[model samples]
Target: MSWMEDLLLLGIGGIAVSVYGVVAGLLLLGIDRKLVARMQARIGPPIRQPFVDVQKLFTKQNIVPEHAVAWLFNGAPVVALVSSLVILLYLPIGSIPPVLSGYGDLILIMYLLTIPALALVAGGFSSGSPYATVGAQREMVTMISYELPLAIVFIAIAWRMSADGIGDPFSLVTIMQYPLWGLVGPLGLIGGLILLFILLLVTPAELSRIPFDTPEAETELAGGLLVEYSGKNLAMFYTAQGVKTLVMASILIALFLPWNPSGLLGLGGILAAGIDIAFFLLKLVVVVFASVTLVRAMVARFRITQVVGMYWLFLGLMGIIALILLGIDAIGGA
Candidate 1:
């Protein structure tokens, strides 16, 4: 195809992916709420509650605090939502490939992941509320805390793949083609599980969900980073939150659990793809349950100190141990 056709196709694909990301992301968020409530022995709002909440917020009057920097306070939500959607285009959906694939995908995602949180910090600071400021500071600190363990998990996996002569080990396509579980021995298997465990723990902090929700501790900060937000802007942030939850879950599925039962069942062609896609969505449900909903139901919000200690100190150490085991396994196999 010519460059013009490519561009047109790309544009169409981008729009399609964005729509899917928004809808699927919101649905997952609502499902998470329902599951968390059930786990807590309370009847939660309907699965469509997130959709309703977003719609209601869109219709409300958007308020800007008089003391706030009007420009950034307004712009942050737009950036957060758009960037989160951008991430979806780079991810594979079941048997479908990424809309935009390249060698630098993981690196690109690593950078893109930071943008939403940075936007949150900007929005918080721009709002000029003491609560928002504190929340923003906490958000930044939390971001720093999680990066070490997150890096160890991805890098260890990619590095192991490279050692086995896999090309472009950092590529999601490549990783999916050669899952770590298939490549590892007993030692490596244990290490891979530990890394998976680390990643699962990291998920809550990435989403700013419970146990890591100090940034938005409503009980204390009265919504903290979002204290001054309302109406359309707040709706955008809320939707972005859901989209980001999808992003994290998708990444987790891509990394440690990119399996489909189609192969086991001897499926092929469109039917196989369909089955795989359905299975991929099911994996999303299980992963979101394990990483977000289960944690939310079981764990209370961690103080900033606890957040730092948990991610940087505890998880960080475990990540290193896992990486060491993978290295030893590689050596023994060689």
Candidate 2:
């Protein structure tokens, strides 16, 4: 294609993915709230409540603290939202290849995943409130804690693929094409299941949901990292949270459940694409429920120390065991 055509395609694809990310992310948040309410035997907000909240927030005043770094405080939300959207461009949605698949891979996606949280940390510290500073520190601790198991999950799968002589094992497309499950033996299957469980647990921490939301403990820190944020700035953070949820679930789906309904049904063309997209959305809901809704409903928030210990000590050990099991399976198969 010509340079002009390439630019046009990039623009079009970027817009499409952005729209899908925002809409679907908010929808998932709404669904999650409704499900949690139902589980607790309480009436829930409408599925469109999140949209209403965002709209209301946009109309409110945006206040910058006199002591805060105004530029960083205001710019953080945009950075967070934009970085989250960028992940979708590298991720395969349904049966569609990523818009920029040739340009990046899973490792790049992993790095992009940290950008939003880092932005949040920057925003928190910039707020200049003691509470916000503490929250920022906690957020950094959470990020560092969960990263080990997350990295292990990626390495374990990629190692198994490379062991089987697959090139580009770290590529999202390659992993989706040859799912980790199909490459493993019975032992490795069990190991993969363990890793999958760890990844699901990581999802809540990545999104700062309940049980892992120490950085945003409303009761203690009075909104914590976002204590000084209001109006449009707060709304941006809210939308970014929703988008991050979608990004995490999408990555989980791509890594573990990359199957499409169209392929199973032996269909093709636009009809297949439609069915596959619907199926993909369904998978996203399942992931959100299993990883976020259900887990949050069952547990109370953990202390920051507890969060660090849980991720680095407990979950980290489990991930190592899973990797070892996969390694043994690889050797046995060879």
Cα lDDT, all candidates: 0.92, 0.95
60-95, model 2: which lDDT tens digit per residue?
Answer: 999999999999999999999999999999988999
Per-prediction tally of clashes: 0, 0
Across 2-99, the per-residue lDDT of candidate 1 in tens digits comes to: 98997897899899988888888899999999998898889999999999999999999999999999999999999999999998888889978888
Q: What 10-residue stretch in candidate 1 is worst by lDDT? A: 99-108
- Quote each prediction's TM-score: 0.98, 0.99
- Superpose all Cα atoms of candidate 1 onto the true structure and report the RMSD in Å to 1 decimal: 1.1
Clashing residue pairs for model 2: none
RMSD versus native structure for model 2 = 0.8
- How many backbone clashes can be found in candidate 1? 0
